[model samples]
Target: MTFEMLFVFGLLAVTIALFISDRLRMDLVALMVVAVLAVSGIISPTQAVSGFGDPVIIMIAALFVVGEALFRTGVAATAGNWLLRVGDGSETRLLLFLLPVVALLSAFMSSTGAVALLIPVVLSMARKSGLQASRLLMPLAFAALIGGMLTLIGTPPNIIVSGQLRAAGFEAFGFFDFTAIGAVILFLGVLYLVFIARFLLPQSAIRETGNPHPTLSVFTERYPTAKQLHKLIIQPGSPLNGQTLSEAAVRSQYELTVFAVQRQGQFLSTLQPVLSQTRMQALDTLILYGRDEDVHNFCQALQLRRLGFPETEMMKLQQRFGLAEILLPPDSPLTNHTLKEGRFRENYNLSVIGVRRQGLALDTRFIDTRLAAGDTLLLAGAWEYIRALESKRELVVLETPAELQEIPVHAGKAHMALSIMLAMLMSMTLGWLPNLSAILLAALAMILTGCVTLSEAYRSLNATSLVLIAGMLPLALAMESSGALSFVVDYLIREYGNLSPILLCAGLFLMTSVLSQFISNTATTVLVAPVALMTAQTLGLNPEPFMMSVAIAASTAFATPIASPVNTLVLAPGNYRFADFAKVGIPLQILALAVTLALVPWLFPF
Candidate 1:
């Protein structure tokens, strides 16, 4: 290899390392790669930023806006409610309903968007039904992935490959061109998950599915010391503001123990004397602990009737558990403190249900893992105890039905967003419009119709993905430009040139599949698409089959969370070990490869 080749190769390796390390945002990594290429003279400055103007990049950005509109309007959430109602509390019923629900949603919506909308509902149902969360979450994630494969706009990789194919002078894929093969794979994939994988799937995967409605009577019977009580949030300017527990004379006057105080979003543990130094503030939430008689007395004394306590009518004996969310702050004392060290249960008297960090839900083992800033913890305990902890600064409560209901939704905007997306897909598939123009128009429509505000739309775009696609596009171009792709193609053909096209396609498929498991699928596709094109050129065969194989292989990330965002989203929620993917995914990967190899040639006819 020439020195230039080695330098280019080294730069590519470093860029990939940084991307996977996630020490920097992906967009930054992409820009850095472009900078390195320019600085090293491998590509020009103009070329470095050229991908920003690429049509594929533009389309992705627009689609992001469209997706945000769906989310903003709660259409996705509304659709998910159906599945939530069906799953209610049965694991078997949930799996049966969720698989198809997620699949249908993913076929049109973004996988990440679809999964995000469903996760909360799934958790809620799991709690109600007393089912394991692990059993349902993986299926939810897998279904999204499988569904994405069925349509042109299902996932980014499919669109990227289609653009690359068009750029290489072949026809772009229609909205449903790959549906036949993708549908079969989707069916088989869902079946494998429902029947076989569930058995092999780990029990820990379902750890967060706690019973939402635990019978307090049963709990009192078992642990008679456990008291049932109401926790009150003292809104700012409330009657209780600016009063100390001692000065307020809660115990003497109201006959209630001031178990905890949440003032200014910080929880003060009355168990420690130092806590007495802190004064009450506006918006302080008080966790008053006492027997049922004292709770009534405390409420009467404070003139605070209607504490919104879960009553017998609202509380199913099976469905009366409390839910609280806590976020680990950067300077929290709990940071780096394990559950054992933090005396979590002893200190708070709550069971940690789940954790969310950086938009991913974490497993129960997270208690053993050191808490970090930005980590959100979902905990289950008595209503009083949870309210007390909610006052602490270390944890942020994410679920407040009133707050959720307050989020703005533009119902009409959802229809416009949906229309724009359809138009883009139709224009691109029918050859009447360039993919770039169609996408750009769609993005404009979203903004114009107020489906997504301009600022929100811009914020939703995955800048890293765009940068990565743009930055890598040149390097991929350079390989073809420099005859490097042909060199690789020459080497492969010489070694396996005499092999049947089917075997050659199989080899290419396997290579792309393995590469995707380690690197970004877009990166894998950009790097391999050129070689597939060159290999087909060298073999004097149609390139369509080769390209189709690469597209399928790149998107089928079955083995690792790091392999795809969808996988990462489920990591904490499902409590999946890295090996979990291998167990379920390895077989799926084989099945996908088998299906792709069998169908691609027959459909595209290389």
Candidate 2:
């Protein structure tokens, strides 16, 4: 290989390694790669930064704000609720409804944005319905991928391919050009998940057998034959006041089993055998399970309640509308404050339900455990109060709603967003506006409409992706400019020279698929488009077919999280391991590849 080729290849290798490792943030890594390329003189400063001005990148950023606006307006949440209601308990029905919805939304918005908006909704639904989250997340990711393939703005890959095609002297793809093939692939993909995936996919939610708590086991051990039951009351002055059964009891109290507790307006646990002499105070509740009613009664005598739920409209409203969770940030004002002194509920309208420390759940007397940094408080109150808490310098609300009021005023600028997008697509497809100008206009509209504010529009844009594209575009240009692409094309034609055009298209499709899994889809398209162009030139074949192959390959990145942001978003919430993706994604990949390889050449003949 020539020194330039070797250097380009090495840069690609480093980029791949950094992406896979994920030790640094992706944008940071992308920036570093740009710097290295510029320093190596592979690309100029203008080229290195030119990607920042790319229309595709701008559209992606604007779309993020639009998606966020939808989320903030409760539109996405409302849709999620409706979908869940329709889904009910049937997996097939859920898939049937979800796949199309995700795909459609992703086509207009972003796959990452679509997945992020859906994940929490899905997780909440899963927990409520007692279904495994793993079962739903993979489908969500796959659906986003399928949806993104449907439109030019659906994913970055589509835009990249369109830009490359424009550079190669062919008409760029229209907004809906890929829809037919994409729809077919999407339908087949959803069908595979609905009818076939259940049997092939493993039950990934296996919990650890047996309790991990030694102290809790003490009661069971002592009452080996005693059928133990124990009880405790929230005494008016005792440390057990205002705590739930699940959060109380750190170390074991003899052989007593605290089976259940009752609090204001709620039963903490269901189904407990009634015990005699079960007296509860206005502020006190019971936590008892023991064979000997006498022993249970004895244990209740030692507790006291320190406070009572105040009788006030504000308190009642606070109870009704607010949900609170303590975020243990390294620098929180409440870190050292006790519940009473902190005035957590009185001042902030937040009621602490439980504390999570190092994964252990605690609900003891408010003052029993000192609040520490990194302890997650589970609070319950109004959503507004939770939002207000987030504004506090010290507290973070993890589950605050994306409210419409928070949406930038320009969010209603969907009309402008769509118009600009259509104009860009048409310009490229008709060979009127250059790819760069088309994208720049679309981005300008986004800013003008306030769909994305000037600051947000600029901030949300991925400099790394822009830099990667710009720096790599020149290398791709150099390869073409220096006749390297032609040389490679000649070699390929000589080796597979006798193979039909159909097979060549298939090869390109498969190669793009594999490269996409390990690199940015934009990078893959930029790298491969030149070679496809050269091949078309040498064979006197229609370049459209070859370019289409690259487009399909660039987008069919379902096998790994590193391949797509949508997949990564769902990983933690779905509680999915890496293997879960391979299980479902592999089949989808094969299906998409098979369809693309067979269909591309037919649609645009060589």
Candidate 3:
């Protein structure tokens, strides 16, 4: 080997060692690779840093925002709800629904995004169905990996391989070109996860170091007033119509708290926070919390009709409003004063629905009761107002309901977000715009339409993953520039070229899949794709099947947590150990190899 080749190999060994040690973060290790390569003069410094500006890197970053907008607008959660309905609390049935849905989503969006969005959903499904999260999370991750094979934009590796084909003076693989084989793999994968792999997954309970987040049931049980929620609509001739909440004096006159108002929209109803200046309109649905007697009297006195607050309505309330516990500090200015006397509603824009003293519920009219130090108050209001309380010095936020984390922030814009995504997909499919352009446009649309805020879009970008990808791209360039990639390709051909074409394809898949278990699959494909193409040309066989095998193998990152972001995402939540992945992943990898060898040649002539 040339001196430069040896140097590159040494650097790679150290990088892989650091990755395995988990001493430094993956992105930092990647940066180290870039620095070493730039300093070694294998590639120009400008080339070493050029990967940061690659279209693939930018597209991946943009994909994060697009996926996050889908999450924020409740588009992804709606799919989760569909799973809930289809699964109906059966573990076997849930897996059947969860795997395919996640895979199909992964085909269009980022696999990491699909898995991240559904992690909480699967956790919820587990909680509701009395199933272990481990049984579902591993399959979810695997399905996401397989889903990447469904579309060219599904994962970075697909794009990398397609770009490689284009760079070699060939027409790039079209959208849905991968669907035929990917669909077969996903089908066989779902069946394996449901039957064979299901038994292999560990059943460990979710790990918790401290107190877990309180659920809605826990709060409703502790604070009975929460169960007294009711919905009332004002009649046309009602006294409340056209009157501001301040003028209505809802708390004092009717002994009821208007948490929010359900206003009718052009096509749907929207929940608006009940601010002091919010005017009451005829037919406005008032969401109230109070005694049953008060709700009945208020409806009768105001000529309003009462509506049932069913479980679905309560779920909507949970999504639109925030319920949390706050403790009054000893130095709080409002201490020793009743809520009404302290003007709590006027100052904080939240309603104190229940009070607990010394761990006992005070079974009195909480509005008239004086606050005390160390007393916990159950506050109900819009999420924005509740979040505002975080900066208040007088009160300490004790806990928030778990539903708060799962609530969709931009549910009203779901249609807009979905439309943007569809347009982007159609543009890519019809060749109206480049894949990167479509992704960037969709991401920008997400922010412009308020599906996700600018800050949220920035926050949604996974810096570790992005940096890792950017940093590694330079190393691939260094390997190719330094003749290391050529050396490896030549060595493989000398030993494996004489083997049958089918066997040669199988070997390539094995090598790529094994490497993917330790490094980012995108990087794996970057290094292996050139070798596959070169080997195919050298052997006078078609390069298409070889490239397809490489792409499929890169996504077989199921055997280790570090193999793919999707796998690591489920590690802690599933309470899984290292062995948990291999128990199921290794077999899946072998099965994928078998499928690739059997199908790639049939689809793409060798």
Candidate 4:
């Protein structure tokens, strides 16, 4: 091997080791790879940061926002509610409806985002159906992986593989090219999970085993001082107009706590001590919690314009307002910050009325209390805004309030959101524009139509995933630049070129599947795809089946918690150990292998 080749191999080893260690953040690890490569001179400084500029990276980032818009507007949850209606309280029945719906959604959007939207819904289902979350999450995750194979834009791997084919001078695969085989695998996957796999899945101690907490009602009952919820808009003439919340002594003097404050059409919260300095201004909306009499007296004494909350408003909280319980994830940025410092309400457009730790409501008066992993928060806001919370890495929505009935977050925007998404998909499938342009237009439409806000569109981007893909891209370049990729391809063809095409395809499937379990699967596809194309050219065989195998194998990230972001998203909330994934995922891997070996050649033979 050349010295450059050796250096790249050593870098890969260290990167894999750090990823497995789980000590440092994955994005930091990716940056470490980018730095070492740039310093080593294997690739130029420009190449080191090239992944950031890659269309694949940008497309992935834009898709995150689009998927978040769907969730925020309640488009995703509408699918979950379909499952609940058909489930009828049976784990088998729920899985029957759940896996397919999740898979279909994954076919269009980011699978990780799909799982994030469904996690809370599934948890609520677990509570209602007396099933463990462990029973549901793995199936949800695996189905999403399979779903990625359903469309050209479903996951990064599909896009990378198509890009690779084009780079190799072949017509890129069609948008639904993957569907024929993907549909069968999806059906088989659902059957396996529903009938067999759910039994094998773990029942972690973290999951509420017996009766689950009454999610939203508990929040309402536990907030000691907030028996009644009221809204008041501060006008310019109000006596407290010039004073900060603390100086105004609204809580002590009025016996009411400001749950949330909205200013200039943007909602703000006083969770941070810094917010105590947020002076009362005219036209600020205050959501106050207290006894009816105390709130009435306070409003009268202060001459604040008390806005009567319509009974209809409270009745349709999901449509007008939303309630949900969120759990902080391990090693999250929000873990150590108090609500005030974190500006939870300001960032999320939600109100924090209660916090639960160790199954008991802590003192809500301590707005500065530091959040911890597994800390439960009861938040209320516009259902659309509450839906946006799922996109936040720091907070995992655990359960939708049963009281809200999972109200659609977008009132008029659902049709618009769905229409924009379909148009984006049609454009890609029909070749009206390049995938990147189509995605940019769709994402921009999501914002222009009020499906999501500017900050939200940006927040929707998963920086870690984007960075990881970008950092790893240079390694793919290095593989070809240093002759490492060609070396491996030559060796494989020399050994297996004469084998039946199916066996060769099977070998490719195993290798790609295993590699994806340890690294970013998109990166795996970027690396393997060129080699697959090269091998096909050398063997004088059709490349489609071989390329399809790589695409499918790249997505078999089921066997490890660290395998895919989707799995990582579920690991914490499911309270899973690494072995839990292995025990279930390994078997599914075998099944997927069998399916690929049986089907790929049949669909696209040499």
Error of 2 at 105 (Å): 3.8
Better of 1 and 3 by lDDT: 3
Clashing pairs in 4: 271-340, 272-340
Q: After superposition, how far is residue 394 of candidate 2 from its true place, in Å?
A: 16
- Over 260-285, each residue of candidate 2 has an lDDT whose tens digit, in order, gives 23555653322122122223334544
Candidate 3, residue 518: CA error in Å? Answer: 5.7
**Per-residue alpha-carbon lDDT of model 4 for 1-606, expressed as tens digits?**
789888777887787777667677666887888888788788898888887898867776777777777766766555545565688668899988888888997887668656765775686566545567778888899999999989988888888878888888888899889998888888888888888886678855454455543645456676554346777888678888878765777755665667456676652311212144567778777776666777678878777777877533343333355467788888777788987678665577665767888888776465768888888887766655766877887678787765454454454587788898888878765678877898889899999999878887887666666776677667777766887765765676678768887888987888789878866687678777877888888888888889999998988899877577788667656767566778888888888889888888787877
Candidate order, TM-score descending: 3, 4, 2, 1
| Candidate 1 structure quality by residue, lDDT tens digits, 1-606 | 666666665765676667546576555666777777667676677876777786655655666676666656545444444555665555666687788778776777567556654665565455435567777777788788888788887777788778988998888999898788889888888888888888778875344254333332333332222344456666545455666565675544554444444455442321211033345666555554455666666655654443554433223211223445666777877778765477565567665545566867553235357777777665544444655765766566554322222122465465666677677656755657765676677778878888778888877765544565566666654544445544554566578756787888887788778767755677677777777777888889988888888888876888865566666556666767656777788888899999998889889998
- By the TM-score metric, which is better: model 1 or model 4? 4
Model 2 weakest lDDT span, ten residues long = 269-278
C-alpha lDDT (0 to 100) for residue 438 of candidate 4? 84
Off by over 4 Å in 3: 71-95, 106-141, 151-178, 194-215, 232-258, 263-269, 273-286, 290-307, 330-333, 391-396, 402-415, 448-450, 515-551, 560-584, 600-606
Query: Residue-pair clashes per candidate, as listed?
Result: 20, 26, 0, 2
Lowest lDDT 10-residue stretch of candidate 4? 267-276
Q: What is the lDDT of residue 226 in candidate 3?
A: 81
State which candidate has the highest TM-score.
3
Q: Per-residue error at 179 for model 4, in Å?
A: 4.9
Assess each prediction's global lDDT (C-alpha) against the native. Answer: 0.64, 0.60, 0.82, 0.74
- In candidate 1, residue 530 scores what lDDT? 76
By lDDT, the better pick of 1 and 4 is: 4
Residue 237 Cα positional deviation in candidate 1, in Å, after optimal superposition: 41
